[model samples]
Target: MKWGLLGGTFDPIHMGHLRCAEEIREIFELNRIVFIPASKSPHKLDAEITSFYHRAQMVRLAIEGNPSFSFSDVEHQRAGKSYSIETVEYFLNKYLKSIEIYFILGQDAFQAIQTWKEWQKLLLLCNFAVLTRPGYENMGLSGALPEEFSAQFTYDEKTSGYRGPTGHHIYFRKVTFLDISSSDIRSRVRHGKSITYLTPDPVRHYIQKNNLFQMD
Candidate 1:
C-alpha cells in the first residue's frame, strides 16, 4: 500500500492542512495519510507550543471523519526533540519495505531542507511529495539542495519525478491553495475572535473546550 506521512507541530490542524493532504493523496494515489504530531520540534524549541497530548488530540478530532486520515504519536513515545529522519526510519523498519512511504511537505518547508538533521539521507530514504502552490514551477531538488548534491537525482519521464540513488523519487506537484493557517487561528482565538470556517467544526469546538490559545 502507498502511504503518505505528514509531520507537523499541528498545534491545531486546520482546513488548509487537511485540504493539502487530501489533494496530495489523490494526486499520488496514496492509500492513506498519517498525521504525526511532533512532541517537541528542534527548530521551535525556544517557542511556546501546545502540549503534545493536546496537539495529538486536536489532530484526532480534526481528521476523525476521514477514514483515509490517521494519527500517530511515535514522537511522543520517544525522548528528546522530534526529528523527521527518525520518524521516517521508524516507519521504514516497521513496514519492512512492504509499503512505499511518501513524505509529504510544503514547498516552503522543502526549500529549508538543509536545516533538517540527516536531510541528505532522509531524501533518498523515501519518496518526497513536495506540495507547491498553484502555478509554481516544478523545480525539484534544484533550489532545495546544493548543485553537487542534487546532481545525484535524475529525472524519470515515466514517474515524472527525480529518482534518487536509493530508488526513491522526489515528486513535486501543485496543490490547491488555501490561505488559512494555524497561527492566524491561534491569534484570533487569543484576541477573543471567531475561528469559524478556518478549521473544522470539531476542531474549533475542541480548542474552545480545552481553552487553548486563551491568554493567561
Candidate 2:
C-alpha cells in the first residue's frame, strides 16, 4: 500500500493544510494520508507552539469524516525534537515491508530541507511530494537543493520529477493552496474575530470550549 506522511506543528489544523494534502493525495494516488503533528519542532524552537495533546486533537477532529485521512502521534511518544527523518524511520518500521512511503511537505519546507536533521538520509529513505502554490510554482529541483545534494537526482520523463539515487522520486506539483494558516486562525481568535470557515467546525468548537489560542 502507498501512504503519504504529512507532518507539521498543526497548531490548529486549518483549511490550507487539508486542501494541500487532498490534492497531493489525489495526484500521487495515495491510499491514505497520515497527519503527524510535531511535539516539538527543531525548526520552530524559539516559537511558541500549541500543546501536543491539543494539536493532535485538532488534527483528529479535522480528519474525522474522512477514512483516507488518519492521525499519528508518533512524534509525541518519541523523545527529543520532532525530526522528520526519525518520524519517517518510525513509519518505515511500523508498516509492511512492501509499503511505499511518501513524505509530503510544502515547497518552502522542501527547499529548506538542507537545514533539517539528517536531510540527505531522509530524502533517500522515502519519496517526497512537495506542494507548490498555483501562481508561484517552481517546477525545478536543481535550484531549490544545494549542488552536492541536487547532483544525486536526475530528471525523470515518466513522473515529471527527479529520480533519486535510491530510486525514490522528488516531485514538485501545484496544489490548490488556500491562504488559511494555523497562525492566522490563532490571530483571528486573539483579535476576537471568527474562525468558523478557516478550520473544521469541530476544531473551532474545541478551541472555544477549551479556551485555546486566546493568549499570545
Question: Any idea what lDDT model 1 has?
Answer: 0.92
Model-by-model lDDT, in order? Answer: 0.92, 0.89
Residue 71, model 1, lDDT: 93
- Which residue pairs of candidate 2 clash? none
**Predicted structure 1, TM vs. truth:** 0.96
Per-residue lDDT tens digits for candidate 1, residues 1-216, read 999999999978999999999999999999999999999899899988999888898899899989999999999999999999999999989989898999999888898899999999999899999988854565677788999989999999999999988899999888888998788999999999999998999989999998999998
lDDT of 2 by residue, 1-216 (tens): 999999998998988899888888899999999999999899898998888999999999999999999999999999889999889998888774478998998888877888999888999998999888655459477657778878889999999888999999998888886888888899999989999889989999999999998964
Q: Best by TM-score, which number?
A: 1
Measured over all alpha carbons after superposition, the RMSD of each candidate to the real structure, in angstroms, is 1.3, 1.4
Predicted model with the maximum lDDT: 1
Which residue runs does candidate 2 get wrong by more than 4 Å?
A: 134-139
Kindly give the stretch of ten consecutive residues in candidate 2 with the minimal lDDT sum. 134-143
Poorest 10 consecutive residues of model 1 by lDDT?
A: 133-142
